[model samples]
Target: MVIAAFENEKNLPLNELMIPLDEDGIERSVPALNEKWKDSRIFTRYTSFPFRANTTLVEEGAALEQWFSETGWFVKDMEWLLGLEHYRFWSTLVYNRGAIESVVSFTQSAVPYYLAGAARSSPSVFPLYSAAHRATLQVICRMITQRESDRCWIGKEFLGELLYKHYLVSIPLLFDLLPVYGRDNKQVLTLMVQTIFKLQPKYGQDLKVGLKFLQSTFKTIQQQIVTDRLDGNIASLTRLNDLAIYTLDCSTVLALLVECYPDCRSICTELAMEQSITNFYDNTIVVLYKNIHAMDNESTYLTYLNTARMELLSAFRGIVNFQLETVLDNPQRSLIPADKFLCTLTECLSDPVFVKDYQRHYPVEQDLDVLRQACRSVDTFKMDFVQNAYCLEDGANGLSNGYVEPLPEDDESFGEAAGGVAEDELAEAGPSTASGPVLTPEQQIEANVQKVLDVLPHLGDGYVRKILSRYDDVEQAIAAVLEGNLPPDLANADPTEPYIPADKLDTLFVETGIERLNIYDGDEFDVLVHDQIKGVMKKGKGMPGQPKNLKEMLDDKSHVREMKGRYQEYTNVCDEYDDEYDDSFDAMADSESKTVRLTAAMRNALVDELEDDDEDDAEVEEDVGQSGGKKTLDFCENPEVVRQRYEESRRSKFQARQGGFVPPGGGSGKDVVGKAKGQGQDKSVLLNRKQKGEHKSSRANHNRKQGATFKRNKGMIPS
Candidate 1:
């Protein structure tokens, strides 16, 4: 009962903490054993670790070596070491500081033994030597830990001199032993690190140095992964796992530094320490997670990489959660950079392949919830950020790979728009083909353009293609062109050609022309109707009436009077126009431009102040209200200078585009009408005849008079 009560006491108040002090304020010597209980006393289980009145540091180290080197010796050292929590009963441990040096030597010696046990890579307890190493670690940690009894603790001024100056603790040694044992056992390591700050808060700088080295190591591994350095190697998994361990080890400890040491959080925030773990999460974990399927035969090693990813994020959350108000010197600013953390999650979570397993093990939503709760607690959250962050609508919504479900009608639309449906969706959607082998959309579009161009021979091929691309239906585009309703850009094209061919001018009015010319085919209107009201009769050609000549067709203006009311609505609007002023835009314009309204007294004061101020001595900028930004006079450039600058900028951008850009091949078929097959025919006719000829039987029209019309003499002006 006495031993249990004695061992369980901890976290005592500073006033309650004490050690025996003599009248001279010096510790009194220990009295010898009582006479009656001397021989029948409690057996000393750790006699091998004997310490006496005159043991030197060298002698103690040798004793610890002897005790550890021999197997099956004193196993009670760990127990006795753990019992030294009573500072008053064990004043000699602090006063006689050689035991610290001795334990450190033993801990160092036990490294080889611990490594031997760890080599099995099994989930068993460490070997005896490794256990001893941890025991020594506890002893050292207790020594450095700040005592509740302020009278007995080491002064911060002498802490660096005694520990660091003597080379007892360093970044290399701490990290070496730390990563080795810390993989399974972090409590001991955590204790030691915490004690380090308790002893001297300034050691946070040393911790930062170690963290920097780890972050650099993490970056190197990330770069190597990005470059696929281990792609084909047999030992790739092993090498990668080792690298992950090395970097993740230090990354985790960074959080420990911020957590265990209070001042270091602010110090590290000044150094932007959050980016270390944040970058590791982004560049390493997220990258590897994305490419996990590629790790085929070596997935086990990559599993640890995923776990390391979660660990890194946990550290990130911890940093953000523990951020000091003065970390940014602005209390309202969020510690979590939403762009890096919150929005990135939204992007990564959209892929069910990643989210399926990730959500299963580490519920990303829970972490986000924790962040939300933390923000509310700290009063530093962005509502827009929290509201926009990704979340599972139904727990099972995105688990399976399927046709993409549309983004939920939720609040997140205000922020990062959810990623689009899969990029290959169009490729998967069967093309415009009639269900044989499917053609690509591009091929279908090209075929459609040629079909439109074929029937509209007067239209430029370029114009037809433009029309086809805009309307995406050959029939509709052809119909629109036939109705003389081309879109604005295609309006410049000559849809109607001249009736006379320039090259055939000599035959325009020859003596045999009117008598035997067969240029006029049949009248487009009914021949009976043409005979009743229009041009010459067609009885000369063994028909009821002759086709109207270009001259007679132009002179027929009967249809114009039939469409007389087309513009009446527009004319009425013009006739009703009145010069009325609009005040609707006044309020909107006032809001957009700065409008300062001053009270009468304020205006008088402003006038007085301006009058008192010298023009030469006036300030260049003034504190602006409402806009919340400074109003400064930026010198205006001369128009010529502005023009030169704009030109230079424009030229540079143009050069860049020209250097790297490849324009889409021109699809327009302009100016192919009256030229040779390649040079004279309009793109419409050339494309229509040539391109369409590939599919249909041009054998029937092979003997037709193709270019004779274009080569023949054209009519005089229609009128």
Candidate 2:
């Protein structure tokens, strides 16, 4: 009947199918369907609806393919059948047994279809407009409840995919279904958490969707934890681990959102704080603290600080109770009372360094009270321990001397009287007992102040004494020392010397590696400065001011001498270069010498090449120019040969000119040589005079020529 109804309604439009069934149709169909299919063998025996048909029915396995093909629920263009009045009515009929199973099987099989359809469907229409969506939710709830069993309606992987699909389609429906399915069931919650974990990396890139899901899921788990339904066994452990993994995965996304969208950080921090507080154990709290502290934002820091202070306070209370019980129950063990231990703990908590971070976020007044109360209680208990110990010792000594008497068991008054006598004797003894004298609170405070003074050079003895006299509280004394507020001593032991701030003295005496001659005597400012200057002077000479022995000083002097020798060697190298330059000039000035004098051009070229290549060629060239002068002068000495070459060059130039050119001086080679010799001028003087006349002629005819040919053709003339 169900199959026939589905087949008949397969062609109906989704909108028409969505109309509610009338009372008559429900009355006529409800009973028939309930009687035929409610407890029928087909429904009772099979996990999924039997979609395949044959004249002789053969039992088919509950595969999802059978539902789509035979039922036509998910086939193309036939999905509207799920919205038919008869189909929804049929879903109502099987609401108890196979409804959830069939829905889960079908949704798991047709996840891609629903995901695609959800994209086009309106939010109001998805997961509820169709009987298939109702069935999908039923199936999800059943799967969550039945998650622990080996025989599941759908596999975990497929179930996870279906859940993610539903989340994409309608987040409202998914959230609604999560509590119904995962609320009380650890296995279901674990699966939900783990599925979210898997999908977060893939689809959770959407901050809104991802953060909402994470926060919702975390709240769900937290609710479970608060109601005490989550077992503390291994199964719950697995569930928590899954939750932790999901939180960690989402933390990175939340952090980015916190930075880019700072307003959202408060929401994220609150969510994290709630989750951490719900799972508030040692390891989880530690992880939360680390993550919160690592965030550079102010909100997270303040949240973490407040949370840590509360957690620490709670833990300390528990410790106090436990230790108190132990001390009360076992008085013979000589254990300190809880208050003493709490005093030590409070000392750590009240430290300015430790409390400096959280003071802005958490109130310190209560903590200061806790510290003071614990200390006062411990002081009272210390007197008790002392009195008890003294009484025990006296009794032991009396027994050893055979002078003690045991009180009768019925005489409670005798025990009270003996305790009173012990207390009185302790009071009369004035804190001095056989063991030792117990220091008063003031003395203890003074000792702690002295310890701070010993380490800090900025804390002078006069300042420390003044602080001690003003503030009886150890914390206040320490604070005064740190703040540098102690009154100055009016009477300087050395009246002749000027007053110096302790910080300046510290820098001058301590940091400068200056050691005092006698620390017992007060620090002498003049002596400290003199010693520091002497140490610096000695260091410059490589003589250690605080050498270990005489031999060390001698070795230092030798080292200094060796360093001076190396310095002298470095200076000699610079002098050698200067001397080379002077020697070159001296060689040039000698008239009879054959050394070559390099012009400024040659010298600059040599220097540039030396700088460019850093080669020995420049040095070799210098040596040859300076020392091998005879060879250079030998090359320059042959004037007749030079004159002959010049005449030949002049004749060649006359031939090459387009207009025939005459040789200058208009004479044979001997006439030129005789004229050059008759002038009694050196080669340099003759060359200069000839160059000057050529320059004049070139300048005079420059405009007539196509270009300045004389200047272009001028080669290296003799200097």
Tell me how many clashing residue pairs each candidate has.
17, 0
lDDT of 1: 0.48
Query: TM-score for every candidate vs. truth?
Result: 0.37, 0.23
Find the number of clashing residue pairs for candidate 2. Answer: 0
Give the deviation of candidate 2 from the true structure as CA RMSD.
26.3
| C-alpha lDDT values of all predictions | 0.48, 0.40
**Model 2, range 1-719, lDDT digits (tens) per residue?**
22332233334321123323245335232322232333322221112232221111223455534543444443221233233344343334344344434443443332222123332233432332244434444434343331432221234454345445434323333333332232223354345434553543333344346556755654564454445433542234334434443343233223323333333333433334323322333323333333333332222232323333443333223333344444556655424554544443344432322222223233334433443444443454544433332222211110011111221122233435545335455556665432233458765555655554433323455555555667766577676556756556523322123224355545556667665555422334354344543222232434554567778756676678779977987765443356788888887888566778999999999898878675466666776888975324464568898899898878876666523545467532221232444558555446656765676565456454534554455743332
Clashing pairs in 2: none
RMSD of 1: 39.3
